[model samples]
Target: MKIFIKTFIFLIIIIPLRAYPQACCTGGAPLSSSLGVISYTGENLVIDFSYDFNTMKDLYAGNSQLNDKQRERSTNSTILRFTYALNNKWAITTVLPYVWQEQTVRSNVGKTVQSSSGIGDIVLLGQYAILQNKKNLVLLAMGPKFPTGSTSKTDNEFGLLLPPDLQPGTGSWDGIGAVSYSRFGIFRPTLSLYTLFSYRYSFQVGRYDGQQEYRFGNEMVINIGLTDSFLLKKWILNPSLQFKYRNTQKDENNGSSFPNTGGSWMYLVPSLDIELSPKIYLHSNFEIPIHTDVVGTQLVTSFKGNIGINYTLNFKKNKAYKIKD
Candidate 1:
């Protein structure tokens, strides 16, 4: 068991240390949100489906806010995720997202819009539980992002192709690694605290059109949160508050760093989880940006929200702890 744990840590650390690729910030992909401690035991399957909406109307330049609200960008994403535990120590998670993105620029020449809708990238992860107990859990996961989304969407007003950020998919292959620790019943029987850290690296690759080679900026995210439960009218309500910090490196376009594309951000996320039954759950969260500092002048997200449902199917039905819903 010790050997296996050391080997898993080595594998995760080596991937990020082997290469350091600077990444961009504008390409919004919900990869890190898919990871969590599924179960303490085996033979459990969890299906999660969610819809996320993100809007960016604020413009900033290196921590300084600009008065320009000329550009509005938004992404409406539908995501379906699955987690299956093979045993107490091994599991798999998959995320498939479909996105509709739009960007509108306003000027004296009127408004011009670029939009597209199609399937986005797919992520597959292999997860291992480092520690599993009644109240404590640690997880490590690494995965590959397959470039399966549509990149051929064009501008609505003009016949030109849209930029990479406006497209539903990035044409590059990427790698991600994550680690998380959770402690339940911290102070009370229903209180829990968790922290998660993840990093993503993008590979420089040619696009599907084979016209331009670009790489989205690598991204890093850190989340710390606490949850507590309350009972109301025979309903179990779990309310959580999380602080998220994200940083992205500059994007590489044709082997050169792109300006106004990457930076750091901090957000406050307040969420609610409702236990519908033993096998069903519902969740929703809203994210509000508390701070933003970009590499240069860039449009940034002001708000985002997500609503989802979770259904769990247990093959064994004989686990010591409940798998996280």
Candidate 2:
């Protein structure tokens, strides 16, 4: 029994730390509002603030070949999410993000640095509860992403347009749809499971730089997780393990597909959520890629970290009151 426990601990603590590929074309805030059960009673307002960072250093070709040159990219993102629940059945959410990015490329002449900082694209989503019970909950959501971020940022030293991959926005509008399902008390009283799937479809931009047409490929993401809860005196501790899969299509430029733009990746994530009070919660998570197969030679993510806080406010001031005659 002791050996089994040690093995489990090692798998959870050490296996997910290995390096992985950086995402090629898809660029958006890494944090999104979590899907949860809604009560059929008073209205609720939920706000979340999160910070995320990722580093990409090694380049890989096809599936397992590493290139010679050393190239690196780093990104830091801050995200804000707001959710309003009208009733137990319907909700709406908005997400905004600010991004700071740096790209370093190595060549025979030397290394060059390019950086950009701006507001990223905004996303608005509406969610509806399809089924809700004591043990299970299901939700459906759809949304549109606006190209509010800048795509024409230029480098400071060279005064030239930065690459499309480093731009804050994709220069095109996109649509996203999602389905989430969760089940509680499945194996034990303290264990719960959930799965979320989302798809994003991209639209073509006529002329991004007045000459070349550009469009990022459509993307899909899937996540499955299990959470175990422990009651620790006055606070509740919840630890979760999640698996995430992402697939993106190739990018198009001037009516032709670009190489090393998209691929499929799998990641393992471990997260912890701490409840300070009934209305306040803190969360942190780490993501590491385990499997990756790109179209060609591309930069990949080595590590990603996220930390956040969530606050829920309940209002019952406007509830219908009966007059006592």
Candidate 3:
């Protein structure tokens, strides 16, 4: 039936994100969380909305876990993604985020808390499918991140400027590139495997009315995952497990490396998806940090979780554009 075909197409989106792109210590939107999971084989417009909650209390010092619980930070982010297929081979996507961050530092004297909330940066990308078929797909995406958010969110306590990590936006233009390979039907029609590689390059920008210049670390991520679906008459359930490794280079200030700003991280993510209808789906995931190594002592994420919904609006397709493999 028509619903069956749509359901088949929707199964391609079962990818669990690299999940948290912005480190818990660095309070920014997790822009790369959903970038590589979109599907272009179908002729339609897909809208995805997600809310991510991340908390950090563990400290790491050069591959060693520290027992410091004096500082804690958490970020709440609401992200919306729109993907519109241009044709069978090309598409366009945009990501918008609204973020809120809170930091707490406790001492014997008392505790100091700082919070900031506002819009985050936006990303626009162009996607091209190098190969597409029912059983396999290869996709490439590249884009630039626009500085559309306010870098002016100040500290709630002193009204002074918050650090770059706590600011709503980075005030810099950045570039992102990604590639993904996916294959399904390995014995079972409802089973699949996928891998994604992505990188982000950051450019320096002036801050505080051009008085100081700073740059976040360049980042690279690799993800591999497996997903399987179980059919239960009228409903379907998809469960997935993903392994993600992320490397972030040291940040730069004026021209020098900034300490405690970059590190290597690995996570194990488990996700579940519920197909509500031919057009609607529910997605949720939990991220657990298995390993972390950082330069200097820095607070790292203890755990992260996100929930979202996906809706696809299908349009009439031009069969001629879809190449047969």
Alpha-carbon lDDT of model 3: 0.76
- Output candidate 3 Cα RMSD: 13.1
TM-score of each: 0.88, 0.86, 0.88
- Clashing residue pairs for model 3: none
By lDDT, is 1 or 3 better? 3
Q: State which candidate has the highest lDDT.
A: 3
Model 2: residues with Cα > 4 Å off, grouped in runs: 1-25, 31-41, 65-69, 206-209, 317-325
Whole-model lDDT for model 2 versus the true structure? 0.71
Candidate 3's error at 61, in angstroms?
0.8
Candidate 3 structure quality by residue, lDDT tens digits, 143-246? 99888777788755446676788887888899999988888787788788888888889999898778888888998988888888888787778888999888
Candidate 3, after superposition: displacement of residue 191 in Å?
A: 1.3
Candidate 2 lDDT score at position 8: 56
Clashing pairs in 2: 21-300, 21-301, 22-300, 22-301
RMSD (Å) per prediction = 12.6, 12.4, 13.1
Q: Encode model 2's per-residue lDDT on 187-305: one tens digit a residue.
A: 79778888888888888775544787878888888888888889899998989999988888888878797766788888898988888887888988888889878887778777888
Off by over 4 Å in 3: 1-27, 317-325
- Alpha-carbon runs more than 4 Å astray in model 1: 1-28, 208-211, 319-325
Candidate 2 structure, TM-score to reference:
0.86
- How many Å off is the CA of 7 in candidate 2? 55
* Rank order (by lDDT, best first): 3, 1, 2
